[model samples]
Target chain A: MKIKGKTWKFGSNVNTDDIIPARYLNTIDEKELAKHCMESLDINFSKNVKRGDIIVADENFGCGSSREHAPIAIKGCGVSAVVAKSFARIFLRNSINIGLPLIEIEQTDKIKNGDEIEIDFENGILTNLSNNQSFHFSKYPEFLQNIIKNGGLMKWTAKKYIK
Target chain B: MTITEKILANHCGQKEVVPGQFIEADVDLVLANDITGPIAIEEFEKIGAKKIFSPEKIVLVPDHFTPCKDIKSAELVKILRNFARKYGVRFYEIGKVGIEHALLPEEGLTLPGQLIIGADSHTCTYGAIGAFSTGVGSTDAAAAMISGKVWLKIPSTIRFIYYGKLNKYVGGKDLILWTIGKIGVDGALYKSMEFTGETIKTLPMDDRFTMCNMAIEAGAKNGIIEPDEITFSYFKNTLNNNIQNLKSDSDAKYEKTIEIDVSKIQPQVSAPHLPSNAKDVGEYKNVKIDQVVIGSCTNGRLSDLKKAAEILKGKKVNSQVRCIIIPATQKIYKQAVDEGLFDIFLESGCVIGPPTCGPCLGGHMGVLGKGETAISTTNRNFIGRMGDTKSFVYLANPEVAAASAIKGEICHPEEIK
Candidate 1:
């Protein structure tokens, strides 16, 4: 699948705290979490993030506790894909399992915010629509790609195992 | 390859593991606490996981809500109890057992070259004794409960070579806080941190566990130290000849290697907002503290309490600073009382609670009022995490926290000691 969107930039170690503050964790609702997406880092994150936008960050994106809410909040906030220099292990697995497309770019610092971008997972390339530049990332495993294609691990697992 | 990689390689049945290889590990064990076990049990039921993958492979600890604080939490513990009985799972509801991570390794549940998954983030604590341990989501944890093998991306290894001598009052907690400051939160993301060097040999088992316990805070998959004579001695008393020597190859390759000089280090604190936003306690002097709580999976060991009790023995806690002490488990709590540590705490006017998660998870008790500041040993001081969104929590070592509690202000341990 291909995705096209504007980009939002973040620095290194953007932890679960920055995504959804711990205070909001009492609830399991997705919309409630979206309200506080990036609340600690940018109080106005909900207002600034447009639907289907992408977030590019430095290394260690989504560090901290194993809060699935962090990725759920980001996806609920209309983030289409997250292209980071690297990702925390649990967050990476959880994000992909939840059907959020997260690509690990080699040098995300070079990309600027509000830059239009096109992500082609089929070819594993992210093209900078504004600058007409492009970057490559590792290909997602076929099993993981199938899970993402099915909208999440739960959905895929349910479809395959439950039924 | 480092100690972590060497262990992972053996567990995954690989001759060797380099970066970026997806390997499925043979999960030697799985653990869950009261807070997370109920959810996992629910999911496990959904998957119809009967008899578990192996009866001996799973351990259920009724921590977090041990005292059965409220009906809701009490009900959760009940569900875990029923699940454990039905599945033949080993359950440690209360008494002698304290902290699952501490007890598991002590009981020979953890060993070198094994993979363990716990439903708590501090599950990384097991790595200090040379096991590949990491936290998992309740559903993911439930899945592993049904199938003892978990998937993984054989993480790259990072080596930390420690050198020099630590000054008095400088303990394992301070070293971890200092390391976080140097590497930033994500420095070890998706990597296994292999801590080595002569300095590590000097630290006690409890201190070593403290260092590895915070590995999760740094986004590491796990943190490990090669088992040595110190490790053997600590386990020999409990393990009954199960203690084994596990070390990395001399030529083992590491993705990255870092050298930390210990002599220059001092007491460090993670300022409000982020664990990576660290500063020496000296820099935050005079920052008025409203609360001081020490004890968590992170620093709740006997050694930590002994140090804190020594500081509070002759002095009263600052009236303005409400200090609370909650041992990680009932066993530790009993140990404290038997040692007359409770006398020191009570005389110093500190509030001691039963062995429950309490304010650590911000579920109940110890909730800070708006705009108040707390110096706590518990991990994660995010906004509103401990009570009020406006309230701030500064994470510090037990020594620094004790000193700050006595002074009613943020003060480095060195200054008071």
Candidate 2:
């Protein structure tokens, strides 16, 4: 499967609290959370972000809290996928469990905000459509592939446990 | 195998396990709090599972935003209360609840050689007692609740051996802060931090908890101390006669080993934005603060209160500084009151509150506004962590928090004169 979107660039050590502030944690609704996504770091994020926009960030993206709201809000706000140099462990798991695609690539500095990019997940290739430069990331393992194919862990669990 | 490895291998029914191996392990306990619980419950419902795998093994606490910060928070806790009733799980109410890390261990729930998972990042605190515990996301909690199992990738170990005698002001909070300062926040990412040494052997139970609690700050999967006589003594009254503790084998492999000399270390204070920005408290002299908070899952224990009260006794909090002291759990609160620590806090113009995680997560009770600064014992001074994004936070131990309250500025306890 292929994903295409313009980029929203961020810096190193971008934490979950910066993704969605604790003040907005009162709700579990993705729509409500989406309204405040990245309000603390970039207050204009939610207001300006369009659906299917990709996030390109430096290392340690989504550090700190284990609150899944960070991923939920980003996904809810129509950020199609996140590509970072690295990710905090819990945030990575949450995004995967919720079926929000994440890519880890070296040299994220070359990517800039509003730079259109295209990803071929099945083939593990990402091309910055703006510059026509391509990068590669490790392919997802078989089990992860199954989870993504099932649309998330919730649906995967449902298919397994629900009669 | 290391103690962490032993626990993880035991849970997965593996005779031997190595780092980087993926295993489906059975969890002895699954935890979620008010913030994560409602979301996990939502996922659990979506799964349409037959029933909770083991209701008795599920623990829910509403400490993050307790006593209902607002309508939405109340609705969130209401969902937790209703779910607890439906499933017969152990739930802590606002009055009885404390920070999940302090509350669980105080109630004797955390034990050695158990595989525990929680939906809060600080869940790694349980590793202090020799349990293989780590934080997960909400949906992972839901998945564990349904099957009593979790998927895990074993992490290699990083051994931190601390020696030398500690100074009066230095304690677990400072040691952990120094470690984080030494290794950047992501230094130990996806690694287990195995803390051992002459200094750790003499460290108090509360300090051990404090050290392990911040492992996540260093990007560690967990921080653990080998269960020894001290660990056994901690659980002597709480656990039944069957006590089998695990330790790392003599030749246990570690990805890296670090040695910290405690004698030369000073009380540390993590500056704003990142825990890795830690330094000696003397580096931040005369840095005035608007508030002083001496509580949270981190340093809100009885001993922490005692340290704060020791410094605050016969002194008054600066008129400009609003000092908020919260005991982590009901039992700890009662103990502090019984020990007259509450009177000292109140006499010093400090406000003592219930067993809520208030103000720690910037949830409620005393949140900061724009451009305000605070010196707190709570962990994590991230941007907007305790209020407005423009606000600043400095992290220190209970002694520093109390002493800073008296001066309205960041200063050493010895400098209070």
Candidate 3:
């Protein structure tokens, strides 16, 4: 599926705490998590986000703690794609394993905030509508791509193993 | 080949290994805490193994569910305790021990140059003592338990070379926080951080441990400070000399090299929401605080307590703010009590919590309310981490944390003491 949205820009090291605080981990539900997304940075993040929006951030976008809820919260909030200079290893693995699209763009600073963006995972193209710029990342492995298309590891595992 | 490749090659008996190549190695040890043990036990049952792979290699600790705050967590820990006993696993219950990572290395359970896995992500803390450790899921942990082997992709290695000694008030925690700020969080993802420098060598074993404990926060697989005389000395009493024999080769290669000057460093704090989001502790000067915490695997060691005690001796905590101190483990707890650190803490109006990861994990204790601000020694300070979604947690070293306890504001140690 393709995704289009306006980008919300953040600086380096937007950690898990910014997404879902540790105190909020008492609940395991995703819908409850979406309300706390970026609560550490923008106090009113949950109230302001639009559907199918994108997040553009600097290096190490998800760091500190291995809570998978960070990505679940972002995805539950209808964030389509996360384009960062880099991501924490566990966060990247958790995101991809859970079917949230993450792109590592080397020149992240060039893309301005609030730019209209569209990403075609099948075509490996990331388009900036405001600047008329398009970039591409390496295609994901076939196995990983299948998992993403099926929507996260739990569903993919159930589909692949249970069936 | 990169240094990470070389180290993994050496472990797997290969000359070199590429990034994508996966290989299984002989397992050395497996650790699990109460929170993750029950889940792993369920997965371990799936393999239909009648017994554990090896009892001597298994370590089960009941740290997270200490004091058994609730019925469900108590039941879970009880199940794990029974499982540990039935399987002949080494078990450490509350009042018997504290944190598994702090006690394991000191009790001779962890050795240098061994492959260790734990269900908890902070398992990377063991890498401080030179073991190649990583965190795994319950299924993965169960797989390792079933066959005594687990798969690994050789990670890239980053070399942190130091040139100078730390100045006054700067310790290993400051150095790590500074590095995290410079590299950001994801800079070392799935990489082995090999800390090498004359300055690193001079640090006390506990200080090295404090630095290594937070390596996982940087998203690293492990943090390796090459074992030296200090490392050997720390273990000499509990383990034999032969245990420290394993060492990296002299001509090891590295993918990247980062040089840090420790002498010019000062006390630092990680602002609300991120460990890598660091700024000087003095940046938020004159801001009042509602709470102060001085405990966590990152800075709950004896030295950290001693340093905090030095500042709190004959002093009292600010009447406005509440301060809580939790020792890292029972060993540290006893030593602190024996040395009268607890008296100073109590005399200063700082409350003492059980030796568990309480406020750090936000499981219980020292929780904040809406709009309340706290300076804590724990790793993360994300919004709503300590109490309410509106509450803020600021991460700092123990000295800065203790100073803030007295001032009731975010004050650095240099400013107070």
* DockQ preference between candidates 1 and 3, better one: 1
lDDT per residue (tens digit) for residues A9-64 in model 1: 89887877678765565444578779989976678889889999999998888877
Worst 10 residues of 2 chain B by lDDT: B236-245
Native RMSD of candidate 2 (Å): 1.2
> Comparing to the true complex, what docking class would candidate 3 get?
acceptable
Q: lDDT per prediction?
A: 0.79, 0.91, 0.77
Q: In model 1, what lDDT does residue B303 have?
A: 82
Instruction: Give chain A TM for each model in order.
Output: 0.93, 0.96, 0.91
Q: B13 in model 2: Cα distance from truth in Å?
A: 0.8
Can you tell me which runs of candidate 3 are displaced by over 4 Å? A1-14, A18-20, A24-61, A68-85, A94-135, A140-163, B1-7, B18-21, B38-52, B75-79, B82-91, B237-248, B282-284, B414-417
Query: B1-417 in candidate 2: lDDT tens per residue?
Result: 888888898999889899988888999999999999999999998767758889999999998888888999999999999999999999998678888999999887888878899999999998888899999999999988887888788999999999999999899999999999999889888889999999999899999999999999999899999877788788875554444548888888888999999998999999998998899999996798999999999999999999999999999999999999999999999999999998999999999878787797788999999999999998899999999999999999999999999998999999885
Task: Report the TM-score measured on chain A for model 1.
Answer: 0.93
Ranking by lDDT: 2, 1, 3
The C-alpha stretches of model 2 lying farther than 4 A from their native spots are B237-245
* Clash-forming residue pairs, model 2: none
> What DockQ do you compute for every candidate structure?
0.32, 0.80, 0.24
Best by DockQ: 2
Per-residue lDDT over B103-205 for candidate 1, one digit per residue giving the tens place of the 0 to 100 score: 6775778876578888777889988877788987665667667666666777778888889999777777878888877887777877788888889987898
Stretches > 4 Å off in candidate 1: A4-11, A23-57, A73-79, A106-118, A127-134, A141-163, B47-51, B65-79, B91-98, B106-108, B237-245
Q: How far does residue B141 in candidate 1 sit from its true spot (Å)? A: 1.2
Reference-based lDDT, residue B82, model 2: 96
Per-residue lDDT for A2-108 in model 2, tens only? 98999999999999989998888999999999999999878899999999999999988999989999999999999999999989989988999998899999978
